[model samples]
Target: MNDVFITKAFTYLPNEPVSNDEMETYLGYINGAPSKAKAIILRNNKITTRYYALDKEGNPTHTNAQIAANAVKGLFDDKFRKEDMELLSVGTSSPDQIQPSHASMIHGELDMNKSLAINTASGLCNSGMNALNYGFLSVKAGVHKNAVCVGSERMSAWMTADKFNHEAENLALLEERPIIAFKREFLRWMLSDGAGAFLLEGQPREDEVSLKVEFIDFYSYAHEIEACMYAGTEKQEDGSLKSWADYPSDEWLKQSIFALKQDTKILDKYILVKGAESLRTSFDKHNLDPDTVDHVLAHVSSGYFKEGLKEEFANVGLDFPWEKWFYNLSEVGNIGAGSIFIALEQLMNSGRLKKGEKVLLCVPESGRFSYSCALLTVC
Candidate 1:
């Protein structure tokens, strides 16, 4: 059967790296003295440095569209052109605007005159894989000859001094809700800014090397778990969704600005129990065996989650190859949906993959407890 192949991959990380110490200085005093949340989170996550789309004054330096467009342009060479792409799939947790759509913005930025531009949102960290899945299906069905899939995030823009100050002001309320508070603070420190793009083609030349997409399977356990991480509208007591305009007070408006709410408690449980179960089922459905796996590329946000993931793998009786595992959390933090692709790029650049070798890409998104796993083979 003809398969979709990733012909090219590229990633863009804006600006210089920000160390944990620098983040502390930027965050400054929350209540009194220096804020310890950043320090504690950095220490616990084992993240030393992460790139941000921020200037020296801790302001947004670039928009999400710019970052994603940079990555996509990087994939272009003499053999490829913007018009050659039949589909442009963009995924992001942070979008430039809600109306034009991130994909459309990138399309405009790249000046691509033709292509189906699609934006997959609210998939959180798994959104990138979701975008790739769409491109893969489109190409596999002969609907498109070539496509571009990108995941980008400007998380630094969402995390500002004002947001930290707001959290400080509501410290008491947050303290009363430990789980919510943890999620808020953790995400603030965990998320970083970056973008990754892959050029997918329906066929590859005999001499060209490519990462062939074998199969992709997605499973959602949101029904069994509460909303652990989310943004946008909130449900009202009457079971109707509350519109942004419905908020009549300054306090409500303040809380609604790119609001990201999470229940750390449920997130923890979902990662350990439900997440593992879903992954095992996906593996079974795809006939992915641990022994045949050559590399494992995962998007784990923190050391805490990494430990939980290890436990989950063991629980499912999957022998994880620690030596073959690749991750970039320590250097790049978590770029949400971009993490897995970034790691995959790193693996490809490592020159370890050989023809017929299989690699597994695991992306667990907490937006609504969805997990995406893809099995790819080197060609």
Candidate 2:
């Protein structure tokens, strides 16, 4: 098999940085005071600033396709052209629409002639890694000379002004109690908008520097746990799938929004345990030793998971090098599927990695509890 090398990687974050305090303003007030939801999200998520694709009036500034097209365009140069791309693999949690597919929309936006465009709907956080995995395999197998994998999300569009306004009113009606009802609302503050893309090549030139993909592995523990994160659709009493269009107009309006629903109880229960197990499995299968990995690039949703993840690593008989670990969740919140790539881009530019050094990229997705890890070497 041919080696797959990542020749270029780029990330695009729209608009200005929205601080946690600004997010509190977006949540508005409850009972003439700021909503407690803001406090909960700020305390739990540990995100200081995040970018949202919003205009001055707090309206969506860009579509998902636009965000993706911009990221792909950033990766283009005289050597890599849109027409030279043989495959376009896009992974997205919040697609513009279900039908035309995000990849097709991006192709149209780029005005590319002809290429295999595919959209992988692999939950929220894992979608980017899944898209990269596909592109890596395609290039490795010589199926495509050049492929671009992108993960773009416009989560701000899902939390419309109307939803926040309605949620504030609903919070006012409820009696003082625990804030578990605001899980979905909390996620709105945690998620932001961004796109990341990587250009993969089947063959490498001696004069150029690249990140070589050694191995990529994915593991899932969905069967062992209930749904911890989900968006869109719900099951009916008759064992049939009820889509958004199947519901009443009012019901559809209430449930059809693209916001994600999370059960923190399940997240707390399995995120660390399942994540560590999956990482260990990937390491064992690929023969990746922790002592040899020079740096670790991780896409953890919050800083709160850092110690727990370390403990899990210890449980699996691996010593996690905290000094060599890097993450961007505090600066960018969680961009879902785009998180890992964004983290990778930032780490590569930090001047910490040396040539020929091995780096491990860890991605843990809460949606149905999945994990993907990729081993790469700096060239």
Candidate 3:
């Protein structure tokens, strides 16, 4: 079997600076609340800071394709001609349009070969993992020697002046509004714009060291598919794109547990078996142990969600070496599918992964209720 590896990775944050404090104020008004007190609270609780793709007017600038194009260029400081690339994939929660896919525009903007194969995938926050899976499979299949995977989002345009204003008021006025406040708070965590990209290729020889990274195995489960979703259609006059109901938080958590149950084999022997005999059975299936795994690159889907995983992982006897694995979500906000790649870049940049070290990349997403896990080894 062919082994696919990551050759390069890059992230493009907003060129203009927006402090976490300032962003809290900005988002407070976006939902129409705009009070000094509430804004301060949001800044303190929701996020630290987030980036965006914008123009002079500060409007949501650049289409999803533009973000991907600029990000690819950012990944390669040395001049690389378009003809050098063989395949391209753009994974995003926010697509540039309903059709044609963002890959077409990326290929066009980069002036890449017209013959190059292109595809687009949207699986919410898990899209990055899905993209990595595809890139690895393509190289392993001998279809292409090199592949580019990108994740980008532009949520600034997703909210309009009116919607923004209303969200703010709802945050302040509605006394008994648990659901609305929850939705508004969650949306606030969703940052805007920016893009990240990764270059994948076949296994690199020991001689060329800087970018070589290897893929191990992957597992997924969609047991509770209806827990959360931003689906269905809305009237065009709604200003920003159509919005959907946030899944009940309790249900979402339940689904997450269901997913862990379905895919415990990959994690078996590594961590101490926790809970019922069922969990022990799952552990035995994979022959994994928590202690054997050196680092964990987890899905920081939400601050709350990560906390849940920590408790469960500990309960199951898996000690997550948080220090070894980098987490910057508090600094940059949640970038959806971009989260994992951004985290991966941090791991590589920190020099954390040594030769043969084991790293697990895990993501749990709302809506389509998909949970994905990738076992990777350092080259």
Candidate 4:
């Protein structure tokens, strides 16, 4: 049983930061018109600037693997060599291709000299943590001297107007249903492109403050719950999901079957409730106290949930003052699987952490209602 430590943290956000008004320019207009749901969604999510891997023509400037590979590149310096890495694990909501695994694609982009072990964890936000947890275990078990774990998203490609134009047109002809139309465009305004990577080593860095991996645990309620957020499938009237393969290829365009979606009612209802339960259970199992935490990094899809989440935590005795919280979503948007690591990078760069302090990371996934939390101690 060896101990694991995070020696380095780095992030790569592609291109210039696109402001609220500039999103449509790069993403293009749906149905030859600006998104009517844009302003309202922006107001609720409160994201001011976000990154995209697309050029002005809505063509991809970087693949999902490229961004993750770039983040991995940032982890190396004069003291480190790419070949020294024993493992590479990447997590993402979107992959460059569905055939090859995302990690294999990222590994292909890197300049590593020898064969590298790679793992891909795909899902919603927890995918990154799953990758991290895999890296953590590999390092802890002495199987790997060092591992690079990444969480990234190339959401812009899927969010672009052309992807949903046909469905938007069909809906307009069927009826005057703004709510359903808004649902289709909702994720477009909420997600962006970014990658965050952490270098896990068996020993702590002596020159700089290292984050000691205390524990990484996940709680899932998939058996007791149905999907709240998802893609590649449509929720049937009976609340069952119908896979894309089950539908004809032509029908995929008519309904935009691959669009990222959520049952907002379920998200708003169970996210906090289930998240609190997940936190409380993990805390009790680990014998942790909320008051003992120095900094809390929470990955939430919207800023609208920040305060409400605090209230929920308070109900479960995990209350902490607002000042101890750290998040960077307003400036970066929600980068899905990469969010928690991105927040950690920003918090560490803020120079606020003191040696021996504790940083708790909370990542909740509405895709089937799961939660992941990690405890890190500044060393």
RMSD of each candidate relative to the true structure: 3.2, 3.1, 8.3, 1.4
lDDT string for model 2 (71-173, tens) is 9999889888777888888888888887777788888888766766465655688888889999998889888787899988988877655554444454445
Span of 10 residues, lowest total lDDT, candidate 4: 175-184
Q: What value does the lDDT take at residue 304 in candidate 2?
A: 80
Q: Which regions of candidate 4 are displaced past 4 Å?
A: 172-180
* Better model by lDDT: candidate 2 vs candidate 3: 2
- List where candidate 1 sits over 4 angstroms from the true fold: 24-33, 113-121, 164-180, 205-208, 233-246, 253-257
**Worst ten-residue run, lDDT, model 2?**
24-33
The lDDT-based order of candidates, best leading, equals 4, 2, 1, 3
Candidate maximizing lDDT? 4
**Candidate of highest TM-score:** 4
TM-scores across all candidates? 0.90, 0.90, 0.75, 0.97
Candidate 2 TM-score, C-alpha based = 0.90
lDDT of 4 at 135: 97
**How much does candidate 3 score in TM-score?**
0.75
Model 1 per-residue lDDT tens digits across residues 1-379: 3589998889999998988778744443444445446677777888888888887677677899999999999988877877677788878988877777788788878876565646565458877888988888888988878888998888877666566555455645656422224545567778789999999997764665689998888888766655667666554444344556566555553454346656676677676666677778877887767888888887887866776786778788876858877777899888987888888887876778898988888888776688888888999
C-alpha lDDT of all candidate models, in order: 0.77, 0.78, 0.58, 0.90
